[model samples]
Target: MSTAAANEADAGGHELRDLVTGLGRAFGGALVFSLPMLMTMEMWELGFAMERWRLLLLLASSLPMLMFLSHYSGFEATWGWKDDLRDVAIAYGIALLSSTILLFVLGVIGPGMRAPELVGKIVIHAIPAALGALLGRSQFGQSDEEEEEEREQSYGSELGIMAAGSLYLGLNVAPTEEMILIAFRMTDWQSLALIALSLLLMHGFVFASEFKGSEATPDTPWWSAFLRFTTVGYAIALAISCYVLWTFGRFDGLSFSTALGVLVVLGFPAAIGAAAARLIL
Candidate 1:
């Protein structure tokens, strides 16, 4: 072969190898982030008992978010809309396959089960796994190139990252009865206090600390970061909490106040997750 032909062949080989490596990391991330929910009894029960339409809506909503995540921090660096879409598909595929294999191995799924039950279980669990897959490059080990890309993201993209992070953490715990139970036990005063605490913690994580990915510089005004990132991030967290609760039917029979309380309770962790996303991703 000519010199140019040899170079072209080497480039093709490297691209193929990178694709395989990226897929492997995506699979590892899917399992690592989703293992807890996969083992939860509540998640298993919610799979079959929740409304099919709600499950479908959840799955549908996850796609756009996954695509955005791929653009921001997929298992490999994406170059264009097509690359983002491809990564989204690959991540979702990895999520579904991994969830199916793990559930089957644990006897959580089997041939005896009906199709809806089996499919619902895998689909619900796959949401977070897919997010993890898309986030694998950033969370596991981001390259310098990817880091520069992330830093140049617009303010809107920053909010999108916050929402994704909130959803990931909220989904992990929303299927559990504890969210409702804690909400039930808390008084109005306690809920107010918890909301305040969540904001404080969220602000501390991103702006107040000297962490590696802290969004604020020493010269940056505290109040500016607080209003722009912290407050908005908390709001995103609360919204995601409400959506996750609604999806899981947690708000089905509650009174208005009780439902609000549940949102507050879940928002605490969601807020922290949102703040942490800025640091990590």
Candidate 2:
């Protein structure tokens, strides 16, 4: 074959392989995010008991979130809005199909179920599953070639990535009663210690430690970097925790100190997630 023809064939093969790999990643990510919720009795109950308008609102909001995720860190290396849209479609499609298959196997949905009932269950589950699909690549996709490009990122961009990571990780565990339980068990001193530990770990992961893929601006002093990233990232994490708590209606009748404690507990994971985002993405 001519050189150009060979190059074209190789390119086509790469594209096909990428598509296949993306599909697999999407499914894997969907399962990771969905399986826990699928197994939870509360999730199943919520599916049935949730108001129709609320369900519709969740569905509507999920699309934009999916798009934003795809644009930032998709299963596919998307270049533009068109590619983002395509990935969002693919992610949602995979989430819907995978949720249906798993839920059916689990007997959450079956041949005997009414259409609306079945759709509601699947849709409720698909929101998180689809988010997983979008995040799968960022969390699990490995590529040394992609990692080598050390692009200089702005503060705003870094903050955005950190916020995304915070939200993703925090959202996973925030809806459960355990978050509140864990909070209620902790005293004021413990909460302060936890906050200190979270900041220390976040700094270690992103700025101070020698972990693989850790970021360092050689010109910037370590203490300054530590101060900035630790403070900003923790703030973002706290904000995400509050939003999640509010979203799940976990804030009802809570005292100020208790709510603050809950936010700190959840913020631990969120801060680590933010640090991971800086290192990885």
Cα displacement (angstroms), candidate 2, residue 254, comes to 2.7
Best by TM-score: 1
TM-score of 1: 0.94
Where does candidate 1 stray beyond 4 Å? 144-151, 208-216
lDDT for 214 in candidate 2 is 30
- lDDT per residue, candidate 2, 26-73, as tens digits? 899899877888877666766776667767865785676677678766
Query: Per-residue CA lDDT of candidate 1, range 1-281, in tens?
Result: 99999999999998898778788889888988899999999999999999999999999998899988888778988778899998898898999999999999999999889999999899989988999888888767865665676646677887898898899899989888999999999998999999999989988886544534444566778888889888999999999999999999999999999999999999998998898887777
Q: Pick the candidate with the highest lDDT.
A: 1
Each prediction's Cα lDDT score?
0.87, 0.78
Query: Which stretches of candidate 2 lie above 4 Å from their native place?
Result: 1-11, 51-65, 111-117, 140-152, 208-219
